[model samples]
Target: MIFSNHVLLRESLHAVLSTELDVTSVGGDDGEALTAAHKIRPDVIVVDLDGPGRHGLRTVRLLVAELPECAVVALTGRHTPHALRQALAAGARGFASREQPPAELVDLIRRVGRGERMIHPGTALATLAAMNNPLSARERDVLRLAARGMPSAAIAAELFLSEGTIRNYLSSVVRKLNCRNRLEAARLAEEAGWI
Candidate 1:
């Protein structure tokens, strides 16, 4: 199965992968993907992880939790080590860049289906750096929005979190990064490519 918000990419992958494997379903949203995954019970699920709002990572996590037997392969446009680490932490068995050829993705899917875990070589250094990242996913989200110049109230509204909660997260981020303020923490996270 293939999951991506981009219709063209999903259809293209389905077209190519269906030739060699049983492409059970192609989904463009989390609800559809989860439903199809449950019904089809595909052996391998390829998820595009670079989607807006990091919904792909959430889907990967849910799929892993709900369908423990299914192997997940994270397909990302960003080859950053942080991206690879995030996918792996979410329970993906394989990580591949979208820049890779279709055949390579197919091979990765096959390998992951066979229970062999792998990460893209391009993320080797990034992966090492990402290990030192002290922020949690929610902290990253808050810091990312903060980095974008959003005020705490706006960030809270955008994230559907309380203002106090947003402030707490920001404070936690500052403390974790050992920065004097949220702005400095955001700058540091941005420089480190953690947000």
Candidate 2:
């Protein structure tokens, strides 16, 4: 199955893959993909990871949790290490750049369907560089909320922690990133695709 918000990309992949395998194209949010995936129960799901608001990664995670038997292949234009790491962390079994030839993507889908994990060579290099992410999971959570302009108190409420704890997390993040303030830390993390 092919899931992407871009109609052209979705249709193109479907047309190409349907020649040798059954294909289903789903458009919209992660929820839509999950629904169709449950009904179709496809062997593999190709998701566009560059979707707005990181919906593609969310979809990958949801599909992996709900349909562990179905392999997921993430396609993205942004081949950054952080993107690759995020997709893998979200449970994607395969990763490929959108710029890759269609034939390569088709082969990746086939391989993943057979339960083999794969990553494009170019993306693999990025993953190697991504090994150095310094923030803890909790720190990332706090920074992510802060990046959205949430005050420390608001972030604390959302994360069910005290405001002082939220402030401490923010301080740690700033110091770890060597930034002058939380705002700068958030900006740096966002630019590096760390959050």
Candidate 3:
């Protein structure tokens, strides 16, 4: 099974995966993927860990707890250690990066199906660096929004908080990251995979 919200990318991934492996199902969003995962009970599930509306960690957590026999592989473009840790913490057994060749992803799926642990080296390093980060989870969230070019008002609206609170969060994030400004803080946090 495969879960992805990107229409064209999902289709392409489906095509490639189908040629090498028997894909039991494919879905566009959280609900569809969750339903298909339970109904089909596929041997392996490939989850895309991007997209603003998608919460891949939460989905993996649910699927892992429900389908212990099924292996889950998290796929991402960033190759961040924090993302890798989040995936593994949610019970994902494998991590695949977009930078790798297609053949590697196929191999990762097969290995994961056979019950193996895996992660890209870059992600591993990021995971280690993430351990040293000082910001809280909420701070990370605010910084992530800032990294996306979202102002305090917009971030506050999205997070259901006051604009002043959002600014405070950003200020704290800057201090913790040892950055001169919000942009610098966001950039450093992003590069370190803290957000």
Best candidate, TM-score = 3
Put down candidate 3 lDDT per residue, 7-73, tens digits, no spaces.
Answer: 6667788888889999854655677777898899898998887845668777788789888898999
lDDT of each: 0.86, 0.89, 0.82
Q: What is the alpha-carbon lDDT of model 1 when measured against the actual structure?
A: 0.86
Per-residue accuracy of model 2 over 45-106 as CA lDDT, tens digit each:
99998766658988999999999999999999987766777889999999988888878888
Query: 156, model 2: CA deviation in Å?
Result: 20
TM-score versus the correct structure, for each prediction: 0.67, 0.68, 0.69
Stretches of model 1 off by over 4 angstroms after superposition: 128-195
Q: Which candidate gets the maximum lDDT versus the true structure?
A: 2
| Cand. 3 TM to true fold | 0.69
**Could you give candidate 1's per-residue lDDT for residues 121-153 as a string of tens digits?**
666667667668899999999999998899999
The C-alpha stretches of model 2 lying farther than 4 A from their native spots are 129-195
Q: What's the C-alpha lDDT at position 176 in model 1?
A: 88
Q: Which ten residues in a row have the lowest lDDT in candidate 2?
A: 123-132
